[model samples]
Target: MKSSTMLKAATAVLALAAPAAAQDVTLRIQTHYNPEQTSGKLATEFVEDVEAMSGGAIDIEMFYASSVVATVETFDAAANGILDCDMTGGAYQTGKNPAFQFVGDIMGGYDTPYQQLSWLYYGGGKEQAQDLYNQFGMELIGWWVYGQESLTSTTPVAGPDDLKEWKFRSPPGMETEIFANLGASPIVMDFTEVFTAMETGIIEGTDYSGLANNQSIGLFDLAQHATYPGFHSMPSDHLACNKMVWDGLSDQHKRIIETAMEKLALRSALFFEKANAEAAAELAEKGVTLHNWSAEDRATFRKAAQAAWDDWATRSPEAAALVESHKSYLTQLGLISQSE
Candidate 1:
């Protein structure tokens, strides 16, 4: 009887340990998009893919639309160990670290998002990128494009002159400088609050991702007019992991995450291009006027971008090198003139 009782007790103990004994890891991924947006969709896909690949050993709980942490403070949360990982735009953390603004600034003139990623991952930028984040106790996972940000306003803007004295809602960092250089007052506002700000007349205009984002955030409803020439953001969302959490991840898990992010990076860029094209067409059919930047206007924007780049570069030597390298690349490609 005693032997039988002991065997039963052991069986119960085994049963209790089964789930955890197999493997156990949980990572919290925080982002600023609602669960319905494109970035949210991609984030969901990434989480599921990682779980499936790990065979249930790893789990990532997504905190979307800043449910767990506010958008403005996500970088700080991830760095301070409040969150394990974050999918956020590099520029949003401008106040935390100015060097990060270089990521968004260098892309203003790049022809394709892929080229920017190439420079970041393989073109010697990663060292500086990691160093910038190292100061904040975070590790740079990689970069992902968020699509070109278009201007949306209640009032029409044909050129830089029209932007003067206009209150424009924008994300932080280079975007603020971008609009400021164009003579618009760049108001730093949470992306989620943009729609309300427009409706209440708190801000006159704003810029956000192509179509889905504009519609999802209800920007189109408040601001009927839309314009192209997303001069502010050659925008890309940077993925980051807390240094402590990253170090704790098994080498195998680290490799898996790295490989997955690389594929997702390409997938995300293509998705943005596709989504932007489709969304733009749908909005146009709905009677939204799509303003195209004229040759003269494009040149003016280029000049503004250059001035903004120079202003940021002067703040940090590393930033200056990044800006110079990107310009050199563009000059060699004949996309922009060296004389500029």
Candidate 2:
């Protein structure tokens, strides 16, 4: 995320377009992304559309790069009225409830963003996620999932067994437990240090961003071997508003915000899909070997991941509910058998 901030302002012409009955709202919002990133650019467009749709009555003061607070605190900041919305994600709130882990990034859950989205929109995820957000005094608007993240490695990680051969950067929490059980050494490190760690051979791999994002950061130059069609970690970025603020908004205004957010999600998903595809072609020319693990390997990894999910469910009733919901939905999607 970039550390810069650029305020998007609504024009007076749009202000004149507000319906007389609609209440004018000025929302102060902060996101974990910056203008330089794709997600940030899409979000800026979303805010602009919302402002225009609401005839400028829904003016937003947007801050990028978690300028108002730390990235992880964005949800709580919104809930406490420090900000009007949390344009971050649920994963950072795992400290509050293990259920958040399910909402944020269901590591090794589904193969694609579409599947994860299906569970949310078509399946029961929408209602369940909303309920989870409501408990924290926040209202769930929608989620933007770009795609699964590729694991950058110095050496080839062709299958599950390869993980044990090297120490990689891992996020804190359940992920460490899952990877550790696979006989791999998982080190928790900040994302910024991943390059230097890998350069010095302190770490052999890193659980980084999507294929395109990693390529943009020149990770492929260092770690020529990568697991494409990433097998783990597709985190959902949320657009959540404080429940009180959301409830107080005009129905039309609420719909405007929701509709705009939907567009942002779809646009982001497609953008990343195209980017990764292009990046894949570029990596081929650059001699970077893209690895897509075999189905058997994916299953093995999923089974291990599911075990961690089950253990996490034991941490909270809400977590268990979300896990069961995911299992039922994954079954419906044919990604998991009914017996599983």
Tell me the TM-score of each prediction against the true structure.
Answer: 0.82, 0.93
Residue-level lDDT of model 2, residues 25-88, one tens digit each, is 9998999888998888988999899999988999999999999999998898899999999998
- Model 2: weakest 10-residue lDDT segment is 1-10
lDDT of 2: 0.89
Runs in model 2 deviating more than 4 A are: 1-20
Clashing pairs in 2: none
TM-score of 1: 0.82
Residues 212-330, model 1: lDDT tens digits: 66765667777767766354457768779999898888887887788778877888889978777787888888877777777677677777888888887788766787777767766
* Candidate 1 displacement at residue 152 in angstroms: 0.6
Pairs with steric clashes in candidate 1: none
Each prediction's RMSD to truth:
6.5, 9.7
C-alpha local distance difference test of each model? 0.76, 0.89
